[model samples]
Structure formats: C-alpha cells, structure tokens
Target: GFKIGGAEVSRKHAGFIVNTGHATARDVLDLIAHVKRVVKAKLGVELETEIRVIGDL
Candidate 1:
C-alpha cells in the first residue's frame, strides 16, 4: 500500500484519501498539500478542496 505519515491516497479512487490508522489531522493535511503541489507542477492544474480547514496548522 502507498502511504505518507499514515495518510494514503485511495488505491481504488485517486480523489479519496484514507487514514491508515494513527493518522492525525496534520498528516492528512500534509498529504493533501503534497498532492496539490505535485498535480499543479506536473499537470498545470490547481486542485481545490471541497472542505475547509479551520484554525491553525
């Protein structure tokens, strides 16, 4: 399985992210950030999150 700090992109669907146990909010956020950056750099497309992240990181 593929993962980063307990957060992983779903193998079945690329748009979903799964918590591989013991995952924190920071971990998921970091993973999302990484995916967005990579997609933007490689495809020249900016991804927008449907949910909002509140408070400080």
Candidate 2:
C-alpha cells in the first residue's frame, strides 16, 4: 500500500484509495494525482477518474 498523508492506496485493491485517519480532501486528491502520474509514467497508460470531485480544489 502507498500512503500520502492520511490517504492510502489500499493494499488489497490497487484501485481503491482509503482514508486511514484524518484525511482531508487535498490528501485524497494528491494521492489520486500521484497514482495517475505513476501509472502513466510506468505503464504508458492514461487513467481517467470515474468519480467527479466537487467543491474547491
């Protein structure tokens, strides 16, 4: 599992990022961005988010 702040990419599921504790919206968003970047860089694939983010980013 990869952790950034209180957000983590679940060890059991690569596609799921969960809040360990006290995770803010920014933390989740940052982690998502990180995953996208890594996937693109390593696998030459572009990932698109299935969820829509609302509110200030």
Best by TM-score: 2
How many pairs collide in each candidate, listed in order? 0, 0
TM-score for every candidate vs. truth?
A: 0.88, 0.94
Q: How would you encode candidate 2's per-residue C-alpha lDDT over 1-57 as one tens digit per residue?
A: 888899999999999999998888999999999999999999999999988998886
Highest lDDT against the true fold, candidate: 2
lDDT (Cα, 0-100) at 39 in candidate 2: 98
Enumerate residue pairs that collide in model 2.
Answer: none
TM-score of 2: 0.94
State the C-alpha lDDT per candidate: 0.88, 0.93
RMSD of 1: 1.3
Reference-based TM-score, model 1: 0.88
